[model samples]
Structure formats: C-alpha cells, structure tokens
Target chain A: MSTTVVNTGTEGKTWGGGNEPLKASYGKMMMWFFIVSDALTFSGFLAAYGFSRFKFIESWPIADEVFTHVPFLHGQELPMIYVAFMTFILIMSSVTMVLAVDAGHKMNKTKVTWYMFLTIIGGLIFVGSQAWEWATFIKGDYGAVQTKGGNILQFVDTDGHRVALGDFVVAEHKDRTAHERKNGLWFVDEGTLPTYTVDEVIKGLESHENVLVRTQIINEEGEKTVLSRAESLKQIKENGKAVVEGANLYVNEYGSPLFADFFFFITGFHGFHVFSGVVINIIIFFNVILGTYEKRKSYEMVEKVGLYWHFVDLVWVFVFTFFYLV
Target chain B: MGHEHKLEILRGLIKFKSNTQKIWGVLILLSIVTAVEVVLGIYKPEALMTQVLSMKLLNWIFIILTIVKAYYITWDFMHMRDETKALRRMVVWTAVFLICYLVFILLQEGGYIEGVYSSGFVKRDF
Candidate 1:
C-alpha cells in the first residue's frame, strides 16, 4: 500500500496530483474530514445548549454553583476545580500525542510507543473521572418541593439558608417493606429494585405539616433554595412513606426540574463523547503497541488522534467559559 | 523553475508561522476578555444591570469577545487564513451567516415563549 504525505508548503496540488500536506494518504485525508465533521457535531451540541440557556434566560441555574464538588475532598466546595483538572489532563494528553507523532516523523519507535502509552492512560483516567462526576450528580443533593402546578418550589426562611428535609421532618411514618425482585409482578419480566416507591414520597409530603413549597430564590448563604428539609418531609408524609425512589427530575426537592434535565442531558452528552474518545484512543493505542504504524514508518495515526484530543480540549474551553464561568 | 517554486512554498510556510504567533497573542487577549466577562457576570454592575442595553451591554461585550476568539480560532488554528481567498471566504461567510440566522431565530422565538409565560400560559412566580 502506498502512503501519502501532506505538506503545508505545497499549494494547488489537485486531488490526484502529487505533493499533499504531510504526504497524507487517502486514509489521512478522510480522517481530517471526519475530524471536521465531528467538530461541527460538537459545536451543534454546544450551540443547542446556548439556545436553551437563552430560552430560560432569567431562571437558568448557575453552572458554577451546581458543579462545585471536587474529588478527594469531601464536604468542601471547590468551584470548577474538577473540570479544570479534567481539562488539564486532556491538554497534556494532546501534548503527549503530538510528541508521539513527532517521533513517528523521525521514525523513532521507542518514543512513539512510550508517548502513545501515556496518552492512552491519560484518556482512561479522564473517562474514569467523568464517571465519578456522573455518579455524584445522579445522586443529587438538597432536593426540591413539587407544586400542584408542576412548579418546583425550594424553601428558605428569611435567613436564606438551605434547611435540610431531615431538619424539618418532625413527623415520621412506617416505610413499607419491598417486594423481592422475582416475586414482584413483571410486566415484561424486568428486575425490580428494593427501593421506596414514588407513591411513598408523595404520600409522605401530604402527611407532613411544617413543609412549605420552596422557590429558586437565594437563601441567606446565597445558595439555591430548591428544596428545604421541611418540604421534603412533607412530601414523604403526603406519600405515606419516608423514601422517594427514582431521579429527582421535575419538581423534586430542587426548585427547577428543568435544571436537572438540562444538567443531565448536556453533561451526559459531553460525557458520552469523552467515553467514545477514550475508546478510540484505546484502539489506536493497541495498534501502536502492535507496531502497525511502525511498519509503515509513520505515526500519523497518533497525529490524527492528537487533533481530536485537541478539538475536545478546545470545546471544553468554551464549555468551561459558558457553563462554569458565565 | 521547480527549485524557485519550492523556495516560494517554503517562504509561505515560514510566513504562516509568524501569523500563528499573532493568533496566539490574540488568544491570550481573548482569555483576558473572558475573565473580565466572568467577573462582570458575577458582580453585575447595578448601572449595567438596571438600565439594560438593547442586547444587554454586558452580554454584548461577551458576545463580541467570544466572536473575536472564534474568528481567530477559525482563521489560524484551522489554517483557513492561509488557504486560497475563495476557501477562506467560504468557511468564514458560512459560519457568520449561519450563526446570525440561528441567533436571530432563537431570540425571536425565545421572546415569544417569554411572552406566553408572562401571559399566564405557563404561570411563573416572579
């Protein structure tokens, strides 16, 4: 098989004519096109995110406030630190990938293998970090009150401090025992979990006395009064139980169910991209170890992935600016 | 003739490197502008906040700064600046016209949605 080399120095070299950038073969050109299209796909996602923010102009949840948790530090509010670390990891991986490509240019096999290995590890760590972040977000904090009108009301006294549902849960109810997974009636034979039903939380809300529907206003500590202790207890009482199962999407003890939805959708989409990127990097990494590109006397494969890694970093820069900063 | 053509191509690549440096400088400037935007957004000045501009003075500043960054990213990082004039214009114009159209449609529709919410179609509490 013939390899194509493309060089920025050559101009007016038609498709079939000789002298392309880096002597890039057809595969490399196709990869470039793929990267461009993929870049556009990411831009479309970000623009849609921007459109939604514009749609909910006044009441959008502040991204910085929502994503304040950092790994390795429990109970400490670290803003943008985790995402910044992720950004650094991605950027550094790009650097390693680029170096590997440079070594490939000089036909240095050892350097290529070493740098490719580092880049793959970087990608794996990034994907793992993202998984941890998703877990934390899915298991939410400081839940909200659902109003009859489908509005989520979070609570705060005049002081504006987020009062936990536990603090206000003065009355208690006996929670029902869960049905075994096999014993439960299966509509289509799906497994069941031993968790409180949504009905229970609704009944508990009805039974509670002191709970008030909270709003998305800032409490004294200047946090979202999305859900208060009193309101959550009330929800459980109304539902005739103590626990609420399922995602706290709409009107959960958080003030805006839309906030959760957007959070899950946007970040989930980005996380999916990161996951796919890592998987692709893994394939390339294995190929590098197997000396596939080394046989060709070029590591343009690494360069191509480097471009993708940098593109991901570039998108994150905007995401951080808009989501975390703005 | 071949050697002269090769020299010309090498010179072009060299020139492109200097242009890239300029783009990097612009990126640094844009970074500073972004930081300013964050600060303004966080501690929104009362004057700017209360007497909003036609498109929000603060928001306009952010959009302009962001556009500047986008322009440089397209031109330098994507190397459109070094391409044939037709190629350069094709990419830039496409992005410009499309982004404008998207923003216009979105804002107009969004305003209508806000109107419906205010009119009690979707009741909101302040």
Candidate 2:
C-alpha cells in the first residue's frame, strides 16, 4: 500500500528506522523475497533445458528410457517410479508440517515434536532417493554412436529393444605401433590402460574373420536399416564393440554434449536445494525436540519452515512435468 | 494486556462454521481439477497434440492446472486471500513478473545455443 505524503512529508516507518520500502515483518517479508528470487533461478535452469530439448527435437533421448530404474527392484524398468515416490514423500511432509503448526497452536508439545520428527524424516528420505536417481543417470545405460552429422544413433534389436553397443558393434582395422622400449624422438613411455584400448578392438577385429561393421539408424517402429545375416556378421567384425559410450553433459555419444551437461546442471542444482532443505529441516526437528519453540509461546517457526518446505515441493512439480512428463 | 479479548478472538477464528464447510467444498473442487491434470499428464491424447507448443497438449493441461493449484496454495493454504490488497498484489505480482521474465530469456538463449550445436562445427563424439 502506498502511503500518502503527510504534513512532515514522511512515508510508512519500520520499527527500527524510517524509509523501509516493505511494510511487513522483517523475517517474513525477507522470506517472500528470497522465494521469489529462488523461483527465478530454477526457471532459468529449466529454460535452458527446454532450449536444448528444442534443438535436438528430432533425436533427443526419451526421459522415460533414461530414468527407468527403481529401488530394490533390480533390472526392472520403472520409469519415473523413484521420482514419483519422492514427490509423494515431499507432499506427505508438507502435511506433517501443517500438523506440527496445528499442534503449536494448541500448545501441545508432544504432538508438535512427533509431527516435526515425521517431517524431518520425510525430507531425509526424499534427499536420499534423489541421490540414488542422480547416481543411476550419471552411470547411464544402453550407449549410442555420435555420427559425423551430429546425430546420435542408438542401437536396438529387431524387436525394438535397445541393444547395448557392446552387443552389436565389431571393430576392424586397428593400427597400433609396436611397443618400443622407448620412442626415438619423444622418448615417452607407453600410457598404461585399465582395459583393452580402442586400437586393440580394432586389431582384434582385423585379425578375426568373424566380425563386420554395421551402420544404420533404427526407427521407432522397431525396424533397423536392413542387412543380411552375413552382412550383419561382417559389420560386427568391423565395429569391434557392440556398445559405444553414450553422451551425458560430461561425455555423450548423443547429438550435442549439452544435453548431458544441462541434465546434470539443472537437476543437480535442484537436488542441491532439496539437500539443503533437509539440513534446515533437521535443525528445526532438533529445536522442536528441545522445546525451544514451546517456551517461545508460538509455533510460528514451524509454520515458517513449512512455507519453505512447500516451496520445494512446488518447484519439484514443475521440474517433473518439464523434465519427465513433457 | 488484553487476555480476554485475545482468547475470545482465537476461539472465534478457529470455530467451525457453514462458511468453513464451503471453503472445504472449494478445496475439494480444486483437488478435482488437480486430479484431471494428473490424468491428462499420464494419458497423452494424440488428437489434441500440437508440436508448436513444444510439448504435448496434455502437458499444457498439466501446466495450467498446476498454476491453478499454485493459486489455491498461496490464496487459501497460505492465507493470502485474507491479506490486504497491497500485500496480495506484492506477493503475486512479484512472482508472476520474475517467473515470466526468466522463462522468456532462458528459452530464447537456449534455442540459440541449440542452433549452434546442431551445426557441424562441434563434433559430438558420444
């Protein structure tokens, strides 16, 4: 509300001093401002993600295919199951937060403490689940090829199942220098490696008569660029490995490496927020147990935390829709 | 200093009335709207789909419904509905402007980056 200029030509005054723009409680008003700024930050991240998805509109990886892992259900494809669980947990925590605030109103210390504890536990569970989701995404599954045309061609079986590059690729024509005890000019020692090098796969393909190179795109109809059985065998030999490393933001065998980069950065940033929220919730949980707010004669602190908690849930709603559902 | 008045006021505010029941009715209606959004999100309709939207029409449904849910959250759950007009305007307007600003800028820049990436200059050796 605007204040009319008085006889003294003064505006509304805050408790501490005059001329404060916002005429509200210091902490509460500040919290609203902070939420506003934070919401923008999240929007920026999501917008970047949208841009990338638009760029690779034709060949972007499907969200369901990428995030199909479920907890304790090993090898089962459970698309968005984990994230859905996290959403439910956060929503339940919001309910607990409201209960704690209600208990605070009645001055019921035991109920407040218990409700706060439940909310804290819910937050922790959500953070842990998110961490697991991140781990699965970072590790990746069913690699693809980065073509010279900047398109990603992923391998799939005749049945339309995603085939690991390791399953179908065979390498041919690998050229490696003989291990010289020392190089004449560079005098550098051979770099040690963990597994067989790409050169080895190539060499192995060259020496072996059974493998061949198969190159073509697999369409959504579960059809591949057709090849005879003999040709398929020949292609496998030249390809060396059935699977090739796929792209992530760090490294992706996809269109632009930016896809993985945005995935990690945007989702990682949101995950960081959830993590911090949990820590703050833990502090509040301890305070509730200690009866700190009980002595203060108000459960307003719980309500404030509840506001923050719900904000996180609100953000996730958008994230899930944009990232997965879309 | 005014303990009697304070207690009476608190009691009055917390009391259940037909008015409170109406509010609950409104909440249920909002919840139904949310449910419809969820259903549309899950079952994407082919006929309603449009690529220009950058997402499925079903997804647009979800987004619109989510905004509605957000409105109820701030208005009813957070008690913004009862606040003075100035306070309500400050809260809603600030969020609306910033969110729109961020969305516009990010999408434009992101599209630019995507164009650069699609070009042959950068090799994606995934």
Candidate 3:
C-alpha cells in the first residue's frame, strides 16, 4: 500500500501552518507568553503581601527604621539611601541589557559583548547588595521584646530615640546552659538563645530612668505609641514574654512576623530571578563570543533574554515601591 | 534581522536619535522618578501624610511613579512598543486586569478581617 500527502492550499495564509499572525517567531511568542504568566505569579505574591499589610496596618513595621543600615556605615540611621542605591544598580543593568539587545539587532558582536559584560557586572552588584541587606536585617540593630499578645515593645529614650538592649541590659551569669542532643532528648535540640533574657531587660528598664516603652500600635499621629514611664514599666513587667534579637519566620524585632516573611519570600524570589538571568546572560555571552549567533545570522537569542532581564527589573521596581517606599 | 525602533517617548514629547539613545533616555527618566520617590519617602512631608481614599498621599504618589517606571521598562526596554497591537494587548491587558481584580478582592477581604479583629468579637490580642 502507498500513502499520499495532502495540502489544503492555504499554507501561506494567516491561519495556515508557518504563518506569523503576531509577526513574532515561535520562540519570541513563547517568551512573551511565559512573561505574562510570570507577571501574574508575581502579582499574586504582591497582592498577598498587600493583604497582610492591610490586615496589620495599625502595627506594621516602619520600612525606614528597619532598612537603616548601609555597608561599612555602622550606627548611622540613613534610611532609604542604600535601597535607593540598589534600585539604581538594577535600573542601570536593565539599561545595559537593552543596549546589548540593540547591539545584537545590528549584529555588532563587539558592542553586544561589551554591553552584555556591563549588564552582568551590574547584576552581580545588585545581588551582592541584596545579600548584604538581608544580613543587616537578620542581624537586627536594636533588640525588642515580644509580648504575650504577639506585639513588639521597643525601648526608647524620653526624647523618642530608639535605645538598644545592649546599651543598658546588665548580663547576669546564671549558668544558663543550651539544650543539646546529648544532654536533652536524643532527637531534640534547642534553637539559639537570645542575647539577653526578658527579666534582664525588665531590670535594665527599671534602672534606666529615661527609658520608655514604645508599642507597635500606631497612634493618631501615625507613630508607634510611646507609653509613659510608669505605664512602660507596668506593661513590660506584666506582659513581656521573650527577648527577640532579629528577624525570622516566627519572630521579628521589626514589629510584625508577616512583614519579615514577605520581605524574605518576595525579595528572595526576585533575587533568584536575577541570579538565573545572570547565568543565562553568561551563556549567551559565551555563545556570542563563539560566533554562534553570527553564524546563525540572528541575534534574537539576546533579545529574548533581554526581555527576561528587563522583566526582572520591572518586578524590582514594584517590589521596591511596595516593600520600601509604600 | 534589523527592525526600526520607535524613538520617541512620553507621548512624542521627547525623541532620541537611536535605540541606544532611547534606552539611556528612559534610564534617566526612571532614575529621576526613583530619586523623587526616595526623597519623598525620607522626608514624608507633613502635607502628603493626609489620608486620601484610605491611603496616604505620599503612598499614592509612590505607586503612580512605580507604575510609570513599569510602563517605560515594558514599552521601551522590553520593546513592547515595537510589537503588534495584538501581542501587546495579549501580554499587558491580561496581566493588568487580573492583577487589579486580585488586589481588589484580597484587600477588601483583608479589611473585613481587620474589622472583625478590632470589633472585639475575635480576641486576637491578650
């Protein structure tokens, strides 16, 4: 038996096979579709974050106070400066990425290579900055106490300036031993203990006449509620349960646990995207150097990856606004 | 393949000589917007602190500027403006519509939950 091929005589039409309806190649169209889906995923994360913030609008952590540290500048309360620098770095990298794509469009190999190199360098700097920011956040500057009601109570001087527990807490040698697998249950071990005990903090508060307690709840003037000296002593002595040093999933000295959770989750996800974008750029960079695109007579690969890189930057713009600015 | 780039931005108010120039121009615009945002955030002018439609005026400004930055990044840097109208709408309209709906529903629900928490019916705090 024999088989014969059939053609519908519409092979070159818009709806026919191999027709470019959107005037985009299969790879580019697929990239656009992927980007749309990815945008939705990011939006879901951001919307959830917004929901949580709305829920705790009265007691949310102040972004400025939390992101005050800059590299090599200890004890300086310069808020929004470091984050602004990170934003500039990401935006600059995005600019370089588009430059690389433009050079690729012209099939200028030297220009493409140089722009790609700059873009990769910018990405590395942004990632490094993010890591440093995470470190500063996790190793909190001024420790606070977590009350039984899950609220944070921070110490402040009479003038409303924050006071660190390390400034006043007197350490007592009380033979406090860490629980280990060898000494305790075979499968159980305790997490790292806080720097100071709640009782120690209370005793320090009692001795420090100028110190007051500030609750997480925002008052009429849109600031954390600072209680009077007698009220501060009463609140801390009665309700304070644990000393919180830094941020984590369960506890954060930065007012709300949800804030830290979203901070880690959202920024971590975006950082992962930046990292993968850099890796892909490196691969494309090597391919350009090897004359792969020159031989293929098309540098659309660079354009495709450039779209992804710009998308990463776009997400960061929103993240920076929502996480830090708003 | 060589394709012509749309060189003008800001509704034809500004034009660039080439695609590279346009990229730099958009970068400058974005940087300026970010700087303004940082200044407002740091200073938090007392006038902008007034609540408008349940949000601070400063927050509104930041969100609008952020959207402006996103638009330029997509239209210029991603070359969305060069694409066909169908493709642009397919990518943009879908995300925008869905995200707005999701945010609306979630925020409303969050507000309701907050009311419940604060109304003394649910004792969340000790």
Which candidate gets the maximum DockQ versus the true structure?
3
Model 1 / residue A206 / CA error / Å: 13
Show where candidate 1 strays beyond 4 Å: A1-25, A175-183, A188-213, A217-253, B1-100, B121-126
TM-score of chain A of each: 0.73, 0.73, 0.97
Query: Which candidate has the highest TM-score of all?
Result: 3
Q: In candidate 1, how many Å is residue B31 off?
A: 8.5
Candidate 2 or 3, higher lDDT? 3
Task: Give lDDT tens digits, candidate 2, residues A107-150.
Answer: 78898889888887888888788778777665656555434444
For every candidate, what is the interface RMSD in angstroms?
A: 5.2, 4.3, 0.8
- State the displacement of the C-alpha of residue A148, model 3, in Å, after optimal TM-score superposition: 1.0
**Model 2 chain A weakest lDDT span, ten residues long:** A191-200
Location of the lowest summed lDDT over 10 successive residues in candidate 1 chain B = B1-10
Q: Candidate 3, after superposition: displacement of residue A310 in Å?
A: 0.5
Steric overlap count per candidate: 49, 32, 0
Docking class of 2: acceptable
**Which wins on TM-score, candidate 1 or candidate 3?**
3
Candidate 3: the clashing residue pairs are none
User: Cα miss at B91, model 3 (Å)?
Assistant: 0.5
